[model samples]
Target chain A: MSAQSAKHMIAKNIGVLGAGQLGRMLALAGYPLGNTFTFLDTTGNPSAGIGEVIVDPENQHLAAFLDKVDVVTYEFEHLPVELVKQIEQHKPVYPGSRAIAVCQNRVEEKTLFDRLGIPTPAYRVVESAEQLAAAAAELGCPVVAKSVTEGYDGKGQAVLKAPEQAQEAWDSIGHTQLIVEAFVDFVREVSMIAVRGRDGEVVFYPMAENQHVGGILRYSVAPLPDLDPSVQQTADSYIRALLDELDYVGVLALELFQTRDGSLLANEMAPRVHNSGHWTMDGAATSQFENHLRAVQGLPLGATNAIAPTCMVNVIGLEGDNAALLAIADTHLHRYDKAERPGRKLAHVNVVASSHAELLEKVRACQALIPDAPPVEWSFESTL
Target chain B: MSAQSAKHMIAKNIGVLGAGQLGRMLALAGYPLGNTFTFLDTTGNPSAGIGEVIVDPENQHLAAFLDKVDVVTYEFEHLPVELVKQIEQHKPVYPGSRAIAVCQNRVEEKTLFDRLGIPTPAYRVVESAEQLAAAAAELGCPVVAKSVTEGYDGKGQAVLKAPEQAQEAWDSIGHTQLIVEAFVDFVREVSMIAVRGRDGEVVFYPMAENQHVGGILRYSVAPLPDLDPSVQQTADSYIRALLDELDYVGVLALELFQTRDGSLLANEMAPRVHNSGHWTMDGAATSQFENHLRAVQGLPLGATNAIAPTCMVNVIGLEGDNAALLAIADTHLHRYDKAERPGRKLAHVNVVASSHAELLEKVRACQALIPDAPPVEWSFESTL
Candidate 1:
């Protein structure tokens, strides 16, 4: 090829389905590679701080947006599978529509995990009040009934503590397909961010121990200090299997539960960059957002080595105090340009240090700067 | 104050005089802090890939653009000082008009250096052919004659080797005001990037050794290897004096020459984020771009510690081979998304390593990937 065409070939225009913080970060990372982005979001103001946002809520103009870009990816998994499939016909949609379709529905996700021999909590599909009662009896008390789709951040889910509450749970969520899962007594919640390249190369970031309040992630510590090497191996193997099965090409976040016996059970998976991997932006040699863009663009994967111990605290629903946040030494603050609302993921703070103690100290100082910040549990033992 | 007012106060809209790579990187670094940028450039397409660009060549709508931003700064030193003065009336122009005016004129810049007791080469202003001959005779042969204004990257300058060449040099650039300086027989070129806060706190990044071809910088290695601490101290003191003299706020780069006797002489200074300090993007705890924004916004300065040894290679007027560039492990590639032209800076490669030897190896590998790249001289003996 002539040099001019070759140069033009290297420059790509990528389209994103959502303009949230993930898309914003993706643009931030991808722009350095000389890549341009066009975002399709319901809101014209996408968290992608800089990009042309096409507001097409009903996906009526997906083709118009698709025609302007060479490849397509989404910031969130909740985008309708059919929309992705339609875009795929015009241009390549990375991570594939099948992966999004499966991950968007709890039943399909769990079934795929089972098929791949990955361990997960026992679950039964519940279609009606009778099925809910039966599944509750089989799974025992305190079984969690989750909507198969359209559920996120503790939404569209309820716990049935007794048989008497089964009908109430069914009445609330039975309008959609559901899955009743046996509540495993997990000791710690952790997640691993893995990426698969177009050429089938797979890599995983170090595991991050997570703490959630009201089902919203509050903070995460990467590499999950003192983690059993075998658990990491198991998580890697399971994610590898999923990547190969879905023929995925982008960042995939696998959430898992560590039970009392030291065994791991799959919780769920995100088809895009995960909140837990946010620490990579400040702590790792390569951030998850950058890696996702690299993988989708078919570039070589970067080193995922952790540069230091890091803690990522989400600034959920609280606004202001930006000046105070900038005062903390060595703390990297990322504010998503989104309107603040209770329970909304507004921004995040990354505190990195040479030691775990120093990291915890800085994290505390950062929290103190924001008076309304949610409590960040510092469980040192998990990182011992 | 209520939290809402405090939050609104933190959100700042910054305007830049030139939308070049420096401004682009500044916008990139500042965006994560929730700061937005509006760039004013003659070119409709600016390197600031992600910000609102206002293309106003005649300055007729300057007030309209200034009305949209809270503060203003410039990317390059060549901008008209009068324009900056006009903007200062509407909003704060960082580094102020005095700094820009002095730095833009070689006569004023060298005068200030002498007044501050900083070591610099002996020179004479040449406004006529007779003055050029007299200055060359006084300074001896091989003197450099440079335009007092609008000179950069080897342009608007000529080196006169013999007395007979003075007439030709004068005839070539006699229309503009010029300064003729005795060229020092220097052993090395080094630079220091320093930042001063609004609160009067000062910090400096480690010195960087630079290599230039045709007066255009080709590469720079940070920390200057085994540079003498005293030399660093001297550079720091001189820069601090300049900062205090100008009441400077934001990043300033001081370029100096290291003679064989180890004495340092000031060459020039850039009153904004500089090319020599680009390695900070990957090597330093806080990049120079981010620190510039911090200083201008009155935010606390970040740590200036170098995380590792780093080398920055400028990609001047070259394109393609992006895949080959990304193939190198741990190499950070920054493409400015500009149309390629001879002598234009289209991109840069930052290679970081744990040790200087390893860094050299990676830098060599990076050079190999770009066939037309300028040679990078790795002087181990100087570093040692």
Candidate 2:
């Protein structure tokens, strides 16, 4: 398209709602494409420490900021709803506030899924201690208790292996509103990603199996061939239904559980680019970062095919020999410049290959070089 | 490696010989891996104008510039050997002065190749107008005449379809020093990329099929499967012989010709990262750019296995919308930041994929979205 054709949609700058690694990566990706990135953070956050960091949402001319750029997008779902609403007054904020609201609350997300005829773990809203006791009785003793709002990477969520741990989990959440879900007896945890444009066109990347540990993503592998076709379809349906209901207008991730019975259940939805989609950087035709940019910019989505069976391993907080890790062949490591602390999201590497097995071998090789990492576990939940 | 380990290497901040796109990219890639980049171009040639554009290489160094960094490497072959020798007293140079001496001139490179028993196109010395005439007659009517000391990208070279074009070619070259070679009827081009650390262990990447247009590199596809095993062996032998002959270090590109006789003939070599290796950025085990830095730093050479079947297309003098091209998925365009003009290397986009044919389709699609570029014809000399 010519500049004249793009003049209608071209905003002078983009106001990314959350200035974290995702936003920083988006900024990096967009900057070279000649797009200006204005970051939104709590002002003191490291993401804002480098780029055009904006803290205050009020008393600023939203019009001027919107006027300078095209549209607004966020890297994380934790952006304030009021700020999102305020930004909407001036320009479109996508995946819109509704998507954020639904994705932000596990209860609301499950309720939406249930209403949309999408399969989710048997879940119930827990209002208080008494409600949790009754809900767990119905759901099961080993059920998971999660705060209805604002939880990610295993925070504000706990497993009730026994009734003794329920109070601890409840007290840990400060008795906040929570959702009790029957733990899935799934064989594999996987995710499906899609980019939804304003015109309602959606492009889905090949499904990927995710492995998580300690509520943290440890690795993600694509074209999850072990996944049953029915499960894959069900996962795709759940994601599309959620996006359709929320009117999502960017890349969204649907975390799913492929049960032992071959049934796929919706676990959660992320409104923005999710960690599971990081493999797209080297594996798929479009990276989640670039696709999010294109989706929010109202551009045509590119091909959503995996060029290879890809594995993305998060370089969680380890100050290993940087040269050693980087010297690995065909391994692309992306450092977020985060301080290396135990369990911190420091950097990530995407390994691409012709097959999932080869990618796993690469992941193993690369992970071996990453010093101080937790021992490589072949767990289903933990993924990087 | 720590500062203590790096200390023994006599950390010399590299003074790149040329300030062009290669230098600019070399700087961008080198610095992040822990080396500082200083260029020789004055007033910052617009191509190398991306980051901390070093405008006066000499005065800038004494102005406490060299204090911050260690070691030096050249981006191109034609870096004045004398200037490099002058800088040698201050910082160590990789690929060394010997590499420059051998690669900068066609006569010298040919002599070295012949001495090493490498097969090349039939040729003879053409120093003067009379020499050009005699050489053409001996070689045949249709020949390629190139200045022995300076020629590249079809510049300083001409094709003689008949003897009449010889005098014009000589005049075009100013009849200073030239070599006329019998133009071989080759089918395609391929290149072998290898990196040698100070220890002399050569790590080679899978050979790539090179496709060129208008004498400028347009695309390179890796893992050229059609190559005969014997020819591939010969190519490796040829590179090994050249590196040994030059006592070379760092990443080097060996372009070859796949003649009708099914033999690989010597074309030329780039002592630094060549355009054919751009796919390595996202497609290789270790990028040529990073490996070059590693080799220059006296570090271990990396594995050269390709992660994907990748194709790279150069965006030359684009008149279309930058945002349009930038929005495309899987597109990595490296703009030199030079003022867009007719026939200048502006930017290049690498489309990485698993299937060779699929990557070509995307390249064509991207080429359509970007500005008009003349169809680059692939001769037997692009990668070969």
Report the number of the highest-lDDT candidate. 1
Model 1 alpha-carbon drift over 4 Å, by segment: A1-8, A43-45, A381-384, B1-4, B43-45, B381-384
The prediction achieving the highest DockQ against the true structure is 1
What's the true lDDT of residue B137 in model 1? 92
Give per-residue CA lDDT, model 1, range B43-128, as digits (tens): 65666777988887766778789889988888888877887887888899889999999998898999999999999988999788
Best-matching candidate per TM-score: 1
Give per-residue CA lDDT, model 1, range A1-384, as digits (tens). 787547435538989988889898888888788888999987655567688888877658777898899889988888778878877888989989999999999989999999999999999998888888899999898899999998988889999998678889988875557899999988889898999989998888998989998898988998666778898898999999999999999999999998877788999999999899999998887889888998998888877878788999888786646666666777777888887788888888888777887777777787776646666665455544
Question: Docking quality tier of candidate 2?
Answer: incorrect
lDDT of each: 0.85, 0.72
Q: State the DockQ, from 0 to 1, for candidate 2.
A: 0.23
Name every residue pair that clashes in candidate 1. A24-A48
Worst 10 residues of 2 chain B by lDDT: B4-13
The digit string of per-residue lDDT tens for model 2 on A103-187 reads 8878778888889998888888888877887788887778899888879788888888766666677888874799998988888
